[model samples]
Target: MREFVFALEYEPGCNRVADALADHPDARIRSLSLHATDDRLWRVDHATGTSAALEDIEGAFLNGDYYADCLATDDCGATQTTRVLDRTDDTLVLYSTWERTPTCASVPHIARDHLGDGVLFETRHEGRHYTWRIVHSGVGDPAAFFDALEAAVGDCARMEMLRAATTEADAPTGDGTGGASGLAPEQEAALRAAVEHGYYESPREVDVGDLADHLDVPRSTLTYRLRRAEERLAKGYVADERFADAPSTPL
Candidate 1:
């Protein structure tokens, strides 16, 4: 089994859902579902944010145009439909299905085309970056996949390869020195930047945007690193059994 992970960094306002995240900067999106297909890309997003922000996200999601960025052409005449479920004050659930087009497009369709069928997709969207972690059952050529992905991304967004196969640095433990456990150097740097920049202070010494500026990286890049770091640290505080039966859903 191989996990070919990659991320897409879109220009602000280039992606509708990403643009929506920009409007509600505090909202975070996570997907966990296996539901997808060649003609349809299914998404089940669990959104956390202020109620107003969730509402806005819901509206933006229901707007079919929110999916234009994923299609081969804005006028490809593809169709997208969404449904809202499990509404809450701080969290909202959204499900969407995007039908495919003849033109090679979308991470899901393109991945299936090159990587073979049954390639699972998972995504996290916030701000300009839409991160995808694809789970493929068989060994595949990541370079070939990325080349196809890069062409599909084209001028609309910048693409970066984050992590694919596990590496020594990705080990659950670090060198037997005073170094903290697990965190990749980049992840650690992101957390350090955030803390030093007062990102954790009340009212925040600076929001993500300003902190990102201080670090001289795009906001999407900073957020991706920070979020990955936090997830690892947070898991350290919980019991392994707590997630023994957790669902692994794909976006």
Candidate 2:
């Protein structure tokens, strides 16, 4: 079967939470997941440097016409009776039930309808754009899915294909040696976090110190881990000619 990964970008003005996050420089929704019960429910996980902004989010939910109820903060975040919300200090997790299904124009909703069974791996808000990682099995024609997605999002959004590969359904999944790099889970997480946080950016949005703080590790420890992880990834790239055409950047 064929599996495709796509990164979809959405406009901030079109989404309420996205707009609120855009207003807060240090606040962002790190991940989001939606499930359809009797009522459609969304689980939103976010991070913000400022606590006041989080309170503002809570207020937005309570006062807004969209949500039905609001609850107090727990160890995780906060929960509304109609939904679930939690915040641990700077990190926020929200579970909200929607009164109605998402419109057909929604990109994710379109993908869901077309793919039949697709996976939303991750979702994050950065600046004016919200990026989503969606993976799906190819139906009769994968191009058809893209066409539908483009039509749903219109000319305002951008969609990039990150990876497309075919694998047997019963393929072995032991140590992941058959995969790209055999780096340990911790190493993989460190490398992904580094890239996502813009550690490799020319201007460098975050430094090792900042990454260490985010990971709750000592600066020296983070340095050692990153160095080792980079080395492993580099060696993996060099050993595999399949990635020879890929970008030279470590990420």
Candidate 3:
């Protein structure tokens, strides 16, 4: 199967649920179960935040014309039926089945429209950014899907295509034979956090100290993990045939 990964940045005012979440930067929603058909979208989400955030989120889900992952909605649009599976002061579990309307456009619908069936979706909603990991049996052109999604989203949201690749379904995820990023789990975690937080960006969005605090790890530990991860990546890169074929000279 192939995987098409992308992200959407929901600027406030474009989406009610995302707007309600704008104030709670630390709040996050994780997908538990999700499926979509031509007529309905069913989802179960795990949300964590303060009471205020949860309350606003709940209202947005069941009240006025709110729908997650939808770019637009209009009057007389079909509303969603939502239930609170569980709620706590800082966490909420929600189950919703939404009726699809022609006035609205969502990621899953667009994907099905373009990419066809036999696709699975996983999502992560953090702050203003939502990342979607879609797996399909190579149904449609990922490039076309990206363009369609961007055009459909228009000015309501920003789209970034992270990955568009085809992989064997039975391929080993990682053989642990020290090939292609054979990092220890801790090292990989630290490196991923660093990259996600822009540690490697030019002019550096974050330093090791800042990233350590972000991950709740000690400064020294983070530094070591990053250093080791970088070493492995650099060595692997230089060892590849493409690099070996390039002209190089010792300084």
2 or 3, greater by TM-score: 3
Checking candidate 1 for backbone clashes, the offending pairs are 32-249, 33-249, 33-250, 34-250
lDDT of 2 by residue, 1-251 (tens): 45554444435444445456556756766666654333234555555646876766655555454442211111212223323366766866765554333231344445555666544446665433454545456565567767977765565455654445554463355333333555545556778889999999999999999999999865644654576578767886776766777688876
Off by over 4 Å in 2: 1-3, 36-41, 59-84, 99-104, 118-121, 166-251
Over the stretch 84-200, how does candidate 1's per-residue lDDT look in tens digits? 878989998887777766653777776776778767777787777777878776556667778888887778788866555532344354432233645656668889888887898
Which portions of model 3 show Cα errors greater than 4 Å? 73-76, 168-251
- All models, RMSD in angstroms: 6.9, 12.6, 11.1
Count of backbone collisions within predicted model 1: 4
lDDT against the true structure, each candidate: 0.72, 0.55, 0.76
Sort by TM-score, top down from the best: 1, 3, 2
Candidate number achieving the greatest lDDT relative to the actual structure: 3
lDDT-sorted candidate list, best first:
3, 1, 2
Q: Residue 245's C-alpha lDDT in candidate 2?
A: 73
Best by TM-score: 1
In terms of lDDT, the poorest run of 10 residues in model 2 is 68-77
Root mean square deviation (Cα) for candidate 3 = 11.1
Encode model 3's per-residue lDDT on 1-251: one tens digit a residue.
77765667676677777777677767878899889998789999988999999998788777756666666644437667889999999999999988877777788888888888978999877655676889888767767777878887788777755455555554566423233566656678898898899998998999889899989965645665676568767887777868779899889
Steric overlap count per candidate: 4, 8, 0
Q: What are the clashing pairs of model 2?
A: 76-86, 76-87, 77-86, 77-87, 78-85, 78-86, 79-85, 84-95
